[model samples]
Target chain A: MKIISSPLELKEYLKGENNSIGFQGSKSIGFVPTMGALHQGHISLIKKAKEQNELVVVSIFLNPTQFLKGEDLDKYPKKDEADKKICKLSGVDVLFFPHVEDIYGTDEVTLSAPNVRGYVLEGNSRPSHFNGVLTVVMKLLNIVTPTRAYFGKKDAQQLNLISLMVKQLFMNTQIVPVDTVRESDGLALSSRNVYLSSKERVEALKVSSSLRAASSMVGKNILDSKEIVKEMRKSLGDLEIFYVEVLNLDFEQLLHVEIGNTIILVEVRVGTTRLLDNIWL
Target chain B: MKIISSPLELKEYLKGENNSIGFQGSKSIGFVPTMGALHQGHISLIKKAKEQNELVVVSIFLNPTQFLKGEDLDKYPKKDEADKKICKLSGVDVLFFPHVEDIYGTDEVTLSAPNVRGYVLEGNSRPSHFNGVLTVVMKLLNIVTPTRAYFGKKDAQQLNLISLMVKQLFMNTQIVPVDTVRESDGLALSSRNVYLSSKERVEALKVSSSLRAASSMVGKNILDSKEIVKEMRKSLGDLEIFYVEVLNLDFEQLLHVEIGNTIILVEVRVGTTRLLDNIWL
Candidate 1:
């Protein structure tokens, strides 16, 4: 697998590959952008990307802009060598690892999240987080020019907002949402999971259990959002809940759950590490 | 020339053309986006676009977001039939004329101009104006996907901001600055020029003349920005000067003019109609 650090070089390399293929024989490129410290979730996304296209490109950029001042940007995990090995084993055609400076500059033009939709749920806890996610994603998308981009559904709101951006901006790439990869104990896999202590790791299971409870309530036709949220809170007992929300596919708050269009999202602090989990019903 | 109002249809049309040509045989597309009260200035941009690319697309969208509340959005000039004829005559391949609703939606993802660069001079007078301009331009650029996009230097700040956006966002389109087109008597062509009465029209000459005076001063090796600006203001006597300042190419205020990298910009109100002109030296 070819590893490129500069966006310009990566673009030039891709352009040359495209030119060599000729227009009629063009190949579809599938891309998976990540913040490194790869987990089962990221590998799942990469595997799905490899299945969908002739070539798969993975970008590992711990974009600083997405992290708020107090967020653990400085301590965010990095496993560069392991990530490279995983990319090679997963059959990635290219690995794009760009520096913070290469991806951002002074007085840059930025993408603002939709005021109403962008500031709810995860955005509520971490304001300006989605803006950073979107800005970096846009930069990556422009550089990669992929036929399809893969995003894990574990970050339901991020995935939703990204899909919205692609549609709203008329960007020329398909955003495919892969299902949330989970642990045997039902906890959603996250890079932040590494931050959890042994005791906190056990408590993190409450996040997934809460979603499972919400899913069971939906199965029993308890479609009212308030009742599901009430039961979800009970399942997540003693965990410091950030929020438990029932929203539509578009991220609009719902009065009641509508199957196949509703998402029951939960975020909780297990020790100092905040964990998120959701069920798309 | 084909005139398309739907962005989707235009995108599909372009995609079909791209596919038909095959990648290796693909032709370059040059684009000119405008607020459609097509005049000689718009024609010049179109003519330049035609000379550069095999396909030329001109979008006539009178974006309302750029206009502050109580501004002349409702009364902005519209000469649809004449504009169409002029485009056809100028050898434009496609004219994308989309409505406000076609381009915007509820709680949309937006582009914010850089705080320092965006809120000075023209931006100072029309706060949130560049945000709207950048947002729409981004949408149009994505929709058109042109190899090169053309902008006249008459709105030097706007052109500069647009170019900055393309670079900062890592957008693929090349932004080409065509020299500002002028009337026989040196009045810069603008759709707003129609708002000026016969008397105000003559007074508007001061706008361009101020830039010309600044240029002549630069030619004589008078690089002192303050001295040039003072004389330019004197030439404008009683014309309600908005801002008469010199700045570097990046729009940062300069203590003294640096030749080959300076822009002298002026804005003034003539009978309730705002006029702006600038020179890039």
Candidate 2:
């Protein structure tokens, strides 16, 4: 496994890999980009990448630009030694560990998330958040030049926007959304979950629990969007619910629960830690 | 030579070409993107592309986004049949002619030019102009995926911004800056030159003439930037000079003309039609 810090070095290495002999299949690459503090969620994304491609490249870059002015940027977890161990064990072919200076310049051309779609949900709370997310993603995808990029549905809105970016920009890579990884008690695995206290961890479960109830309501022949959201609001039990939405795959509001197409998304604050979870039907 | 209006078809064709075995030397593509009304300047660009690469792809797209509201987008000249003939004559392998609808969507992730560089010079008069230019360029570059794309130094700021975009975005394609093509009378060739009436056409020569005088000053070892600019203003004879200054390749202002590194750029209006010209030393 190679650990490359420079973008140019990665490009050179990838170029050689593309041209060199002895690779299986059509010399395809699967990339999984993440912020550090790798948990079960990141591991699952890497696992899916390894299963599908001749080479798997994982990037662990805690981008500073994505966090808002008062967000938990400095407080974001950093478990580098543990992350390295995870990658080595998980059989990652390349690990892109770029410094902040290496990734950004004083003046640069950046990606802007679409006006309407980008400003709802996660974007509504944190404006210019998706713009930062997309700018970094665009850079990483170009640097890696992956044949397929893995994105967990845990960040469903991000995944959808990335998919839109890929389609709209006509990028070479394919975006494959892996399922959300979860804890035994149904809490979605997130690095931020570490910020949760014992009591807060238990409270975080309400997020997934609400999503699960929405899923169950759909299973019990509850097709109306309003009915499910109303029940989800009750299931959440008012633990500082930011939003509980029933959206189509396009992230548009839907009146009817279209099975195989609807996503039940929930975001809630337990104490001070914010948790997001969603269920794709 | 083939004329492809659909981006998907062009991609498929390019893919086949990449895999095919009959090309001489390493299969490289040189691309020249343009709006129609082909002129000597465009022909010069095509000629350079033909000299360097095995395959040359030319795109003639009259992009609406780049023009500000009521900024001659509707009045912009179009010479479809003549442009096609010129492409065929210039030995272009593929001519990508796409309509506006095929290139844009309702909701899209777009490119934003850097604040300082993009919003100065041309961007100052027309805000968000470079954003549209960059967005379309990003789309076209991704769709064509050329080995090396070509741009004339006639639009030095645009070329600089495009180069910046490709570098910052980590795009695979190289931006090759071709020299500005000029008329025998020293007027820089442009599609908008057709909008110049007989008297205005003669007045437009002042733009190039001012740059020429500045170049002569540098030849005579008169290297002070302000001195050169002062003399240039006198040469221009106050024909509505928008901007005339000395700068380095990075587009930052230079106090003294650094031989082999200086650029004298001028933007002037001739009877309501703006013309830009620059001489790189």
Q: How does candidate 1 score on lDDT?
A: 0.91
- DockQ of every candidate: 0.73, 0.60
Question: Best DockQ goes to which candidate?
Answer: 1
Compose the digit string of candidate 1's lDDT tens values, residues A109-193.
Answer: 8999999999988899899999999999999999999999999988999999999899988889999999998889887889998
Whole-model Cα lDDT per candidate?
Answer: 0.91, 0.91
What clash pairs does model 1 have?
Answer: A23-B23, A260-A281
Mind sharing the TM-score for model 2? 0.98
What are the runs in model 2 whose C-alpha is more than 4 Å off?
Answer: A22-26, B22-26
Clash pairs, model 2 backbone = none
| Tens-digit lDDT track of model 1 for B69-181 | 99999999999999999999899999999988889998888998988899888899999999999999999999999999999998988999999999888899999998888
